[model samples]
Target: MYTVMIVDDEPKLRLGLQTLIPWQELGYEIMGTAANGNEALRVDEEQIPDVILVDIRMPGMDGLQLLQEIRRRGWDTHAIVLSGYADFEYARQALQYGVEGYLLKPVNKEELSALLQKLHQQISADRLEKQVHQDAKSPEWAVYSLLSGSHDLANVSIDNLAKSLGMDWPKYQIVLISFPGLHPEEDERIRSFRERLVTAYAADGQSLVLYFAPYTVLLLANTLVGDFGRADLYRELQMLSGEIRTHMDVAAGETVLALDQITNSFRTARSLLERSFFYDKGRVLTLETPESYRQAPSSSKDTSLLDGEEVSFRLYYLVDVGHAEGIHSLLDEVAAQMAIIGKGETEIRERFFYLANETLRKVSPRLWSESIYPGEPAQFLAGIYSQRFIRDLVGYVTAVMERLARCADYTSRDNEMRRLLDFIERHYYENLRLEMLAGLFNYSSSYLGQLFKSHTGEYFNAYLDRVRIDKAKELLTQGLKVYEVAEKVGYSNVNYFHNKFKKLEGQSPSSYQKKS
Candidate 1:
C-alpha cells in the first residue's frame, strides 16, 4: 500500500483529510499527520511516505518551501498542494516544485478521489515497471521479502527461488551480522566482508547475504552443508563468528534451524542480537548460549541520587529547557540507581512512567499542541511500555523528551541556542573557548557571552566549566587518575583542575571517588 502523510497547520483540516479519504479502498494508508513543516520533516525522517498532501501556507515553513527542502534532501516523495483561490500564484510556484496535484481549500470529495486514484495508478505502474526491470531470482531480494513481511510462501514458490540460487539443502540457518553505528557509505565494505565469510563457510554457494537495516546484514546459510553434520556446522559457525567479532568488530547472532523454521529463527536471532546493546559492539551469541544471557537486561547502578528532591527538580527544569544531555545524564543516574536497588522490570517501568509523565506535563503543549489536557496521561504512557531493558527505557524516554524539546525550542533563535548548547555538551572535553564559538557562529565574543548569560543565567566560561567538571567526575568515578582526568576534561594544569573540582564539588577527585 502507498503511504500518505498530511502536512498542514490546521488541525481541523488534518482531521478532515484523515477521515474523508477512503484511503484503504484506494490502496493507500494514512501514515500520519503533522501540524507544521518542521514536525512533518521530523515525522518523515521516521517514516518516509510515498505522497505528502501539504498546505500552501503554514507557520514556520510554507508548503512550497517544505517541498523544496524535501527535494533537496532527495526524498522520493510526490507532493499534492492544498491551495486557496488567492493562492493561485503560490500553487503555480508549487507546480515548479514538482507538485503532482492541487486541491482547493475546502476540498471537494469527488476531485480528491480522482486525484488519489490517479496517484495510486501511477504508483502501481511505477512499482510494476521496477519489478519487471529487476531480477527477482536474487537471494537478497527473496530474503528481504521474507523479513519485510511482503512474502507469502504458501502462494509463492520459495523452492524455486532457492533452486535459482543453486541451494539444495534440507536445512537452513539465519546468521545476523551487525556493525554498530555503521553508516550508508560503509555497506560495500560490509558486503565485501560478508563475501569473504560466505567463501570461508559455504564453498558450494549455499549461503546468501541480505542487506537488512543499516549496520546489519543477514546470511542465509545452509546448515546441512559439507560431509560434517549439524554439530560440526555449529562449531564452524561459532568459529567464524569469533573471527567476525575479532577482525571485523561486528556483533554476530545466529540460529541454526530448518528452512521452514526461518521466520522463528530470525526472530530468535534478533532477540539475541538485542544483547549487543549491553555488551560492547563485538559481542557474539548463538542458540547454544544460556537463555538467561539472552533475556532482557537488569542494571546494578545506584539509585540513591534519584531519590533526592534536587535531582527531580533539575530533571523537570532540564526537560522544560530542552536540555537533551542533561536529561540523558539524569536518566543514566536513575538507571544506575535502579540497577543497585535490583528493581525488576515492573518497578523500573513505574519509576520511568512517573518521570516521563512529569516531563510530559511540562512540555505536552509543545508536542501535542492544544490537544493535550488533564486526565490524559494514557496517551503519553503508550510509548513507554514497550521498553524491555533499562537502556531501552532510557532511549524511549530520551527520544520523547528530545521530540518535545525540539518543539519547545522551535523558534528560530531558540533552536540556534539549543544547537549551541548541544555542541557544548558534546564537545565539553575539548579545548572549547568563548572566542572559538564566537568566531564559529559569527558573533563577537562579548555579545555571544551576553547571549549565553542571558539565556542560562551563567557566564559562558562558567557553564563550560560546569560541563567539564561533570565529565571529570564521571571519569574519576571510572578510576582515571587526577592528571588523566584533568587532561581528559581540557584542563592542562592538574592544580587548576584540583582547584576547580574543589570549588564546585567541595572535594578532591580522589575524595569524591572514594565517597561514591
Candidate 2:
C-alpha cells in the first residue's frame, strides 16, 4: 500500500482531512501530519512517504518551501498542493515542482477522490516502467535470451542497439557457463529453470540476456549501465551454480567477456567446461584472471615423443575418444616440450591456449572464430615458425600414437593367451587347472602358461588366485561369511583358499574380512 503525509497548519483542517477521506479504500495510509514545513521535513527525513498533501500558505516555511526541500533531497514523493488563495502563481509553481495536483481551499470530497485516483494511475504506470527496465537488465534474462537465440532475433548489434535504443554505448560483458554430466533431459530441465529465472528478473525490471546450448549457458550483461551491480551478478551466478548442483549433483564453470567480446568468452568457457574431466564440476570459473585457466599437464603427452600434425591429431583424437593413456601421454610430451623451450608455467599455458584455440579455429571455424589469428597472416606464420607449433603439435600427434599403441598392444597378444584370460575372467568361479584352460583354448599347458604370463605379467595360477581373492573380498564386504565367500569364489577347499589368500594378500581371508 502507498503512504501519504498531510501538512496543514490548522489542526481542525488536518484532523478533518485525515478522517474525512477513506484513505484505505483509496490504497493509501495517512502515516502522519505536520503543522508546518519544518515539521513535515523532519517527518519525511524520519520516514519517507509516497505522497505529501501540503497546504500552500502557512506562517513559516510553507508548503512551497517544503516541496523545494523535498525535491532537493531527491525524494520521489508525489505532491498534492492545497491552498486557500485563488492564485494562479501558486498553482504554476506547484506544477513546476511536479506536483500531482492542485486543490483549492475547502477541498470537496469528490474533488479529492478524483485527484487520488489519478495519482494512483500515475503510480501504477511509473512502477510498470521501472519493472520493464529492471527486467531488461537482469542477468537471468540475459542468459535466457542468449540460450533461446533471441539475441539474434533482436538484431542486437552493439552499434545498432546503442543508436536505436538511445542507450549510451557501454562495455558489455558475456560469461559462458557450462555444466558437464547433464543428460539430455536434465539439460532441458536446466533450460526451463533458466527461463523461469529470466522471467523473475524481468518482472523486477532487470535486463539479463541468457543463451542456452548443449552442456552450457551464456550470460550477457551490460557492464557500462551499472544497471545491475557486478557484485550482485557474481552472487546470482553463484546461486545459479548452487541450484543446479542440488539437482544434477554437479558444479558448473563460468567464463566472462567484455562487450562485443562474446566469441572469446565462449572459447574460455568451453575450455574450462572441458576441464571438468580432470577437475571437480559445478563451480563458477571466471576467465578474466590468469588463475582460472590453470590445469595440470595432460597425461597423454607423458608417454610419447611424436611431432608435427601427427602429435596434434593424436592428442585431439585421444581427448575426443576419451582414451586415458593417449591423453596422458600427449600432456606429458607437451609439458616436456614447454620445459625445453625454457617457458615458465604461465608462458606454457599461453602457448597451449593459443595452439588449442588456433587448432579449433581451423577445424571448427564456426565455433572458434578468426580471433585466434591476432595479427597479419605473414606475421602469424613467422611467429609460429620461430616459436614452433611443432612441440605443441606433438602433444596432439602423440595422443593418437598412444591410441594406436593401445590397439597394437591388444592385437599383438597371442590368441591362446587372450582366450585363456577371457575364460578366467568369465568363469573364475568354476575354474579348472591350467591343463583344462590349455585344452579348452587348443594350446599346450606349458605354452599357454608362458603365453599368459607374458601377456598378463603374471603366472596363470597367480592370475586365477588374484581373481578369486578379489571376488571373495567383494562378497565379504557384502557381509558374506568366510566360508560363504570361499564357496562363492568356487573354492570348495576353504583351508586352501585361506592359505592362498594369506599368501597373496598378506592376510587370511578371515582377517581381511575383519579389517574390511
The TM-score leader among the candidates is 1
Assess candidate 1 and give its TM-score to the true structure. Answer: 0.35
Model 2 alpha-carbon drift over 4 Å, by segment:
44-46, 139-516
lDDT of 1 by residue, 1-516 (tens): 679999998889999998998887777889888877888888637578999999988899888889999999988798999976566678788888888988888999889989987887777556644663385656666666676666656765667766766664666666665554333223355556666666775465666655555333545554433324434544554465443343322323344444445667677667766653333222345555442223323532333455744445445655544555556656766766655555556776777788777766655464546323333557658767765445777777776665555454435544657767876886688677787565445568999999999999999989999999999988988988889999998999999999999999999888998887
Provide the lDDT at 37 for model 1: 83
Candidate 2, 194-237: lDDT as tens digits: 66656644344323434434443433344322323434654665
C-alpha positional error of residue 81 in candidate 1 after TM-score superposition, expressed in Å:
5.2
Q: Evaluated with lDDT, which candidate comes out highest?
A: 1
Off by over 4 Å in 1: 1-133, 155-164, 185-203, 220-256, 287-516
TM-score of each: 0.35, 0.30
lDDT of each: 0.67, 0.59
